[model samples]
Target: MSSQAAEVTEVLVVGAGQAGIAMSEHLTARGIPHIVLERHKIAERWRNERWDSLVANGPAWHDRFPSLEFADVEPDAFATKDQVVEYFEQYAQLIGAPVREGVEVTSVRKRDGGAGYIAETSAGTIEARYVVAATGAFQLPAIPPIVPADAGLFQLHSSAYKNPDQLPQGGVLVVGAGSSGVQIAAELRKAGREVFLAVGPHDRPPQRYRGRSFVWWLGVLGMWEASAPPQGAEHVTIAVSGADGGHTVDFRDLAASGIRLVGRASGYADGKLTFDGDLADNIRLGDENYLSMLDAADEFIERNGLDLPEEPEARDLGPLPADALEPIREVDLAASGITSIVWATGFRSDYGWLQVDAFDELGRPKQQRGVSVEPGVYFLGLPWQSRRGSTFIWGIWHDAKFLADQIGIQRGYLEYDGNGAPSNFVPRERPAVAAS
Candidate 1:
């Protein structure tokens, strides 16, 4: 090993995505000396990983973090992937966030003698008083293990999908009927390719009800503030789309549009894809969840005495024509002329670089509201990190700010009053350092 000396800093933040930038903003505001180390360029995922026509699932208004709002874009409009990337880039510049791009962190471990943490990165070594893992929750794309390596089909995960033209001219099988799956299927169909979608349990909220957008209703109904996982309930996956004016996609609509709605792909058998026959049950479950959300919205409006118009009785769901609800159990890949498969299965967190015992039995970090049990360690941009919206762009600001204060307090730069409020804050006088 080279005898190079390790660089030192007060705080070191990994990943310069929205969460990292937000944390940098708070740290900067409080005069904390920190450097954000990003493995790629700022907003690299939105820039490279996402499809060309992808848009934010939430409206532009709700996508803003603290002290930064989408001024030029329409509030109700969904931001395209490019726009979202530009927004983050501009936000980083606006706040003058000290971000070092293309610095890949290899490992993070506690320093000897309880001094601090040492991070081994592509650049060199870095020792910091505190380390914040702001890599976000969607680190690794999770394709099902059942997908055979030698399936011989051109396969792409949703993160790698750009457009339909990239695939060979043949039928495409899109797995996982979440937001990514439905939207990608629509794009493939629009490109004049035959599409087959694997249906699963998901929520199908309409784009709008009455005169307001569904997101507006959710905001007004306090849905964003609800505690996530709901006190022992597993995290729910809602599959509403942001494309085509935020229309909801379901098996019925997809089937009506001439896209085959198959059951969840179970495995490969004898050159054929096996699937469970649960299309109808999945659709029924989705409808139940949709209706429950509507009821909750109605109750919120009634309880708060809001003068909103009644939901229109003629609300259209664009369901399938009576003949389109057939259950499909299997598909012969070769026989059906299928050439490409897109896995829209969700992502999982990969904290293999972390050398701390901060994870739970489920391999998730055991933290209370983003603060780790290990002092001076923290996490940001995790789903349900603190509340229902913790993972969303609109929610990370709160967690970032809170973690900044915690770091400040630990460094003796800030103190909490008896009422549990931060007071008498003072930033350190040392010159702030930024990684080159």
Candidate 2:
């Protein structure tokens, strides 16, 4: 390649969100030339896809990058959707990330001679010695094909949902009892709409325990460092909330708040939707995980003999309402007056543009950490990519540093001695950034 090569930089990073920004920060700190390509503006998902009432699940302190703090906000407060986007914008500006927004990357393929990768984009073809796909794990909303096509009912994925007013005036059956589903259901109920949430296998950890935020506990306890889940076990989302200055997400409270709890929506037929008889079982399993976490925290405090106040309310989220424990067998959408269905059913990894054999049967990338089997191709911002916190904004910083170190070694900016460890190779700071 000549100095006048028809390209921008050596390393090409996709997406300008936290992951891409973090990777750009590390690469910049290591004096590596790179360009961050984003299909939309920075923090596009938070700015657009989320609902009006959406708040960050994690506290301000634990959720933000280490480089910048949320300005004019309490550490324990949960930033709103706009505030979160502002924080990302501030962080990217502070780091001077070389982000090229509105440039959509269509596909990435291995170059001939196996030397580099070619990224075909809306702008044009760009070549790079290495490619990092940080587009995000939640690409397409994974709405199950459970809804019959001829049902003639209005349906939207969680990503498309904005406010209660956007939906028609009628009862709403919210599928998927994850954070989004539960929160959205509660909001709809509060708006004077009948809401029924289909409960699934979800883990509920309190927002605060022993007078400390759960985010603090997870970080202090190193719980997020755990590896991926066992095979065949789905990674269920944790049920906790940072809304209203943070609170424990209790289903019993939601039930009491007029949001009926139903079992998982299983099938639809005869103008009625069927449910699995697993609501009680799912709640029981979540309680076990919940109490186990509290017990672990209690044991840690006792073992260390630390002086901390215990909040009894965290342990007992009031009694579960009797009717809430029972599951409704089926729901007649028409009779129930349910005119809208919100599928808060999470998302699927859409790497269709990635023309590489780096994924498994489930469309999950086959890699140790972020390094893919194909040389010069890597991935980031994926949930459980390395640890449980691999997808968190703060958590992804650690992953980005590791990937940057690996890239440095591969690009000869860093080195490993005979001991097969990183040598004492000095790193260079950011140089004058080239035009993206």
Candidate 3:
């Protein structure tokens, strides 16, 4: 084996996705010496995971990067996945962020000197004073391995779904009613193929409520405020996942469009998929619950004297065309023309490679805002990392700025306030980990 020397960075960023990119930009803005390590080409997942016909499930105004956005894009509209990726790419180049692509961080471990951590990557090892784990929530798609191999049916996860042409001409079974699942199902139905959407616990927000996009309300609600806690910081389960959480389909529109609503998908074998008998009823109930939450949020806004426009005034844009809805229904494989299965089952957060001791019971890393239990270690890009918008591209700027401040304090670049949290959570220092 060739011997490789270790490189040192003031801050080492893991993952080059949206969150990681934002961190890089913030560090650059602060004139902090840092490096970004990515497993794949930047934004490769978006180019790979999305189908061709896919559009942003929500409006595009709220889908921009912190302080920057798609120039001249339509308002209260959605951006296609490709458009989103292009925007990120442009943002990265604009910031001139130092990114080392195709380097996968296999593991991160604290050094014995107690100064910082060492990141072991395929290319080489990087010793850094701080490591920002910006791997987003959608790292691993949660696919249930229940289908039998003998079923003689094609199966692939949403990450592998390129386009409808990649699937067979027959009908398709889409399990998991998350954003990807719902969007894929709609596309399949539009292709004139019989599609079955297995209802799941999905967050269904109105596409255009009252007269504005759902994200507008979130912004006006201080959901994206910098002082708010990170997404998983609190044990409180959010009432709605919003656009980023799950499928934002309006069930009324889906049903009205002739989409076949079926029960929750259960075990499958012998090329046959089983679902709960209460699929239709459950879907109806889920829709009702979602609508109720929207109403409640609206009420809270009015009671608190928030700046939201009245319902009618807010949703002046009105919902998309009713025909814009995709038709769906439950169908048995042999009888239905569908010959493939696409699992849009959403993704689960995976921290298998992290050697840190800050994870909570739900496999989420513990952090007060972005500061973790470990000193010189932090995380961003989690669901609501610092507020409702923390995870969103537009929402991440404040978190990045806040994290930069904390890092500065830790490194003595910025002095810490008295009685505040300890500047260095890890005791003892070796040669000043972040020396210029």
Q: Among these predicted structures, which one has the highest lDDT?
A: 2
What lDDT score is found at residue 328 in candidate 1? 68
lDDT of 1 by residue, 6-122 (tens): 898999999999899999999999898999999999999899999999988877877788577776678888889888888999999999999999999999999989678999999
Q: TM-scores of the models, in the given order?
A: 0.90, 0.92, 0.79
TM-score of 1: 0.90
Instruction: Specify the poorest-scoring 10-residue window by lDDT in model 1.
Output: 314-323
Worst 10 residues of 2 by lDDT: 1-10
lDDT by residue (tens digit), candidate 3, 8-36: 89999888888888888878876789999
The CA lDDT of each predicted structure is: 0.83, 0.85, 0.70
What ranking of all candidate models by TM-score puts the best one first? 2, 1, 3
Which residue ranges in model 2 land beyond 4 Å of their true spot?
A: 1-5, 230-232, 317-319, 413-436
Write the number of the candidate with greater lDDT, choosing between 1 and 2: 2
Q: lDDT of candidate 3 vs native?
A: 0.70
